[model samples]
Target: MSPLVHSGPRAPLRWAACTCSRDPAFVVDPAVQLVFKHQGGYATLERVEDGGTSAHEKNEPRFRPYDGRVHGVLYRVTREDFEKLAKREGGYVVQELQVQTYDDSQYNALVFVSNPLFKLPQEVIPTEKYLARVREGARDNYLDPAYQAFLSGINTVPGAGLGSEYYNTPSKYMGYSFLVIAALITLAFFFQH
Candidate 1:
């Protein structure tokens, strides 16, 4: 589940908005900016064509070219947190990726991708609530005005489950405490048997 879609607690992350090529990219080990996506994981292509280039996807948009960069945020996470995030985003599979910073710096990072098995039939418009949280976050972080403007005009529905503030504010710590308590209880029950 996307953080925007979840009404539950937020996963902790230190992140910043950046760009990633929407085109095919591969992940490689090195300190330099990578021009590719990791070959072992699922592809994030918005659409695929018939054997166009990627063995990863079968169908692609007939006439459109996907060789541009799109804005995305990068999260720095620990291995444990990475696992938790993947589990939380029911459809996401985690993979290590190399991303280029605005200054041309590169870092190996963990990214969450939608499971190909569950990808939408066609690229669907992002939900209003989803767009709202992104806007709120951009504002909160004082992201580049150009990027904020880009988000402002996107189509959206009315206020969703919760407003965009859910993304701006820190999620409740109580939820984590509850999860820990529940895990202990489950373990105790199993051991007692």
Candidate 2:
């Protein structure tokens, strides 16, 4: 499981430990150190909405190869679940990686790496809500304390309302104007009658 966004208690989605009926769906395996091919890194981009507006940009997280190793939780999932997860992760590619647990036990694992075809021109600061998920995952999975502090110190951009207000205010005001005009027309009709 990805420690950056999907391994913690507060993860948006839960990963089942195994296909067996007795196993719980939300299980946090022991922390592991993963050496990704090409030095995987985390990033986010401005989510371009309709009219090229970036209202939802700050919350999207992407993982690509750069210059860092990823800290993650290990889970034993069924092959079917793995396929489903791969399908769900549309923009990512699956890479077989070697991961080492704290006990120095090593195993081959499937990891999601951002598709090389889809490269962002630049990265923007992620939103607090998104970073909170990452931080929570790191803390809950018992990642290195120093790494957790680093995650906590990460700077975050404001969320949709604050970050994109300038781009959306005109359209918002326009919608309000339409509502006001409709109300006035209804009032005029009722008064005239």
Alpha-carbon shift of residue 156 in model 2 (angstroms) = 0.7
Task: Tell me the spans in candidate 2 whose CA falls farther than 4 Å from its real position.
Answer: 1-68, 161-193
lDDT of 2 by residue, 1-193 (tens): 2334443565433544333221111112222222111111233222233444232232333333222234556667667766766776755677666666656667776667545443333343556776677678677667766666656655676565533322232334566899999999999999999
The TM-score values for the models, in the order shown, are 0.48, 0.51
Cα error of candidate 1 at position 32, Å:
18
CA error at residue 44 for candidate 1, angstroms: 6.2
lDDT of 2 at 93: 74
- Candidates in order have lDDT scores of 0.44, 0.48
Which whole-number lDDT from 0 to 100 does residue 96 have in model 1?
Answer: 61
Q: Cα miss at 100, model 2 (Å)?
A: 1.2
